[model samples]
Target: MLEYAPAPESRSVVQIAPSYGLFIDGDFTPGKDVFKTINPASEEVLSEVALGSPEDVDRAVAAARRAFETWSARPGSERAKYLFRIARIIQERSRELAVLESLDNGKPIKESRDVDLPLVAAHFFYYAGWADKLPYAGFGPSPRPLGVAGQVIPWNFPLLMLAWKIAPALAAGNTVVLKPAETTPLSALFFADICRQAELPPGVVNIVTGAGDTGRYLVEHPDVDKVAFTGSTEVGRQIARSVAGTGKRLTLELGGKAANIVFDDAPIDQAVEGIVNGIFFNQGHVCCAGSRLLVQESIAEQLLASLKRRMSTLRVGDPLDKNTDVGAINSAAQLARITELSEIGTEEGAERWSPECSLPDRGFWFAPTIFTGVTQAHRIAREEIFGPVLSVLTFRTPDEAIEKANNTPYGLSAGIWSEKGSRILAVADKLRAGVVWANTFNKFDPTSPFGGYKESGYGREGGRHGLEAYLA
Candidate 1:
């Protein structure tokens, strides 16, 4: 059993206000309905965040609409300067941002600082260069902004997701009214403060905090020219249905149950590490998490034993700790989903194993679990169990691996591990996922385009491809 130690609370490095309000027109405005954001790791009420209603959505949309006229008309170089300033400010305040994100989102402080915040800044810096180079991006005669963009981001990677939505929208000359998830709205509220610090123009970016209702209002609002959402497949489908007749541009980055395939010829140790990273990173709250494991029949038993031993040693605990590997589950609702799916795995006859780790009594937590002897038809294999759970299956040949990998409705990401160059290329070419990692998993960069296929939803989020949803 992994030893339990009470994780230390966030150090008083930066002083934050007791509550946060909606950020509109370069200022914070209080909303009518206030909601409390809890720290998922400790079940501690972090802060009260104002929830924006339909009326608030309308007000934010108006603010965005007002900003668009002048903001979009400004020279690309001027916009680039603002982006540069924001990037610098983000770097300056990265430590505070990291601590706040870990407190609010249940991800480890290391990941928030090393992975999320750095990428957030890199995204802004990368997109800033594209602001003045849109004409060269092969977008025909004159690529123009689509006016006001309504973006709804998930709680998984709160501030990073916000950056993914806002950076591209603003770079393409569109103003934004963004809605952060209710459970993790604090970092975004703090982000609005950063924008003010950067002297970003009024109304260029507005933040509205609320739950699903606010997201629905933003999407259905007639004045919203574009909609970008990162959430569940069900919600993505609903948004698609809602936006069908409106003619509004829409981009959805939804769910995934990615397949991480290991061939007989692959380097066993490296493949094992990749397997560990594929499913367990960020407690597997990632949309592109490699939840399915397809090992070649020749090495199936060996790989399973290796993976189980590795999973046994994973240090699952508080998010604030730098040494913590798997942190707390995002919420109680997510914990229920993970529990239900894990039970289903056992009911379906797959052998389940979780480390004997002691969890804090006050918070939502789940042990890193692995299910062996899983068939493709199993619920744990087909459904996206967005927690630290791995479903392992065996495949006889390359054809079988490809067949099993693409059998799901989701096509967000896939992983291929093989020593042979030809085999890696062949398998990668056949996978239907938007992002394929050959001999690696969960690799991200600001220049790489990421999205999904089929039920996983559509549109890309990074690189030049990300600009499509924001342009006419």
Candidate 2:
């Protein structure tokens, strides 16, 4: 048996100032208010960040508007060079960014290092190639830039989400004023530095750090020509209402409650690993997390036993620890929501179980949990928990699994686990999700588009479709 060791990643490589300000135009300016962003792993205040006001949002939009004239008129080939530069810089600084992400976002170091940072760099690289290729992208003969993009991203996968919004926006030739989530603003501030390092044109990209109201002001600003948001469905609805009749182009990548369906003929061991990755990865903060596990009734007992054995081996603790498979919950409020939904699941008659896992006392932590005997009507099954909690349900047939999987209001993503290629295709086609995976869950790529249907929000956020939203 392979022995494990504590190999904590060093945090000294990354530096965070005591306080930060709004990155407007090309400078970091003071704000009227400031709020502390804390490390969710230890509840330690990492730094004080600016809380942007309506006036600040106005200034940012104005700066972007001014820059947009020169920025948009620049040749697409020239813009591609800048994008390529930024991508290279990101790759160079990846280790620093990865450690910082683990600190600020409370995800395991392995995830931040391996999954998030790589994808962030990949997104920029992918979009950079598209900068000079828009005419060939089928968006009419000469697609034009939308003046200024107002973007808001969620706390989960902060840097990657920023890349998703900013990369395509810049590739399509739009300037941006983005508001990072209040709890996880440090990475965005660092990204502002990345823009400066790339010598990106002033006001071509801006970062405003604050809570919900700050996002509202940025998205609602009249000078803003495009709005892109990735967060909860509730907030997406509000943004939709605010942008209605405002003549602003809008795209939302909202909430999800994806299903991972496992058939009797499937590889049980591989399915178990995928199930673990689906809901437990990043503490289930993923919007497209496969929170609902639908297993065939025939293999329920066998699969459950194997899953429990694997769950028992998961190492949960510090985010920087290389051995940690799961880390802290992003915040106390998020932990509370996870707890509430879990308790409600028990009250509603689902059997709840969790492997024995020790958690640090100072952090917001929830041990990886699973609820068996879950029904479609259970709140845990219906709503997005956004935590390391999985709800398991059994289905006798493929059609029954399909019915239960589509029972939720979310249609962001789904997964099919079957050895049969025909069965995978049939099930994936029947699923009402925007993205589907066969024998895998929670996989993403820059070349492929991703978004959702129904209440999960409208419009795509990757590939050529992502660039289209930032263009005329």
Candidate 3:
């Protein structure tokens, strides 16, 4: 187990609020039901956050609906200016935001700083440029905003996900009522303060934090014109079912079991690095994590050996530590899901290998794990474990690789590795996934369109396609 010491620099970022409440109509107000947020690294109580009910959702929707009439009618250039101000404020407070994200979310400070916070700002900056350019986006002679959008995001990338949800809605001139996941609501609460700093119009963006009930309320509220969600495939189906006859515009970015294909001709060291990053980044809590590895049969043994050696060097400890590569699991419920799926892997006769890692007594932790001899039917191969668990399978040829990659019901993302550029392009074209990386995995850009096909859910969250979900 690794020891932890508080950093004075990080502690100074934001004072922990005594009691967090719903951010409705540009103010914090109490809710009838409340839930506690915990630090996943140590399983310590961080704070209690208000859990809004259907009535609270109604109030937020009303606030957003009321604001939309005026906010959406404002000049496009003026809207762009507000987005620019927000982008500037986020840049100024990037360090503070990164530290708070690490403290509350159990992702390494390095990732929070280098990945999440920067992407959040980039997303805002990217969308700001589109505020006045919607006429050129092929919307119509004159595009218009959806009155009020209801958004629900997952816990994996809290603030970044918030940016994905809010920036495009605001850029499209839609007011928003967003719900941050119950366990990771602190950063969203802090972000509400950022909106105030930017002087964003009252009720332009309201955050109501809670669990499934809160999300259901927000999605089902008649006042909401659109619904956006990012989470599990099962829940995505449920949301689809619930909104079936309502005619509400809906978009879902759900679960994935992406394949990382390694060809024999690839650079072994770089491919190994990409493979590690594919499954281990953010402790593999990503929606499009490359959890399934399909190695060319000729190099399967060599790749497995190299991957295990690389896994041995990863530092798993306090997320605040700069040296840590893999941090604690997001929450107890997630840890249980990882554990259950891993057991299923063993029972189905796959070989499971985990480093001899000692974990902290209090936090939810799981070591980097790999399963060999995994077949397509294995639960580990088919299910979304949502943890640092990788399953290894082998393919004899490029066609077999493409077949194995697309075998899963998920079509979110996939990766291809090869020295030949033509081969990479050929395989990339054949795979049935939304995002395909020729030589990388888990790479993201705010200007790029991202979403999934089939059961992985629909609707793009970034680029010009993002505005489609929020526009009339």
Candidate achieving the largest lDDT: 2
Candidates in order have lDDT scores of 0.91, 0.93, 0.91
TM-score of 3: 0.97
Separately for all candidates shown, the number of backbone clashes (residues 3 or more apart, or on different chains) is: 0, 0, 0
lDDT of 3 by residue, 351-445 (tens): 99987777778899999999999999999999999999999999999999999999989999999999999999999999999999988989999
lDDT for model 2, on a 0 to 1 scale? 0.93
Candidate with top TM-score is 2
Cα displacement (angstroms), candidate 3, residue 99, comes to 1.6
Candidate 2: residue 412 Cα off by (Å): 0.2
Ordered by TM-score, highest first, the candidates read 2, 1, 3
| TM-score, per-candidate, Cα-based | 0.98, 0.99, 0.97
Question: Across residues 1-472, which tens digit of lDDT does each residue of candidate 1 receive?
Answer: 5555656546586566778889999888998889888989989888888889999999999999999999999888889899988988999999999999988889887888899999999999999999988887778668999999999999999989998999989998999999999899888888899899999989999999999999999999999999999999999999999999898999999999999999999888899999999988999999999999999999988887888788778787888888788888989999999999999899989998887777878889888889988998899999999999999999998999999999999999999999899999898999999999999999999899999889899999999998888888
Lowest-scoring 10 consecutive residues by lDDT in candidate 2? 1-10
lDDT of 2 at 82: 94
Clashes of 1: 0
The CA lDDT at 288 in model 3 is: 93
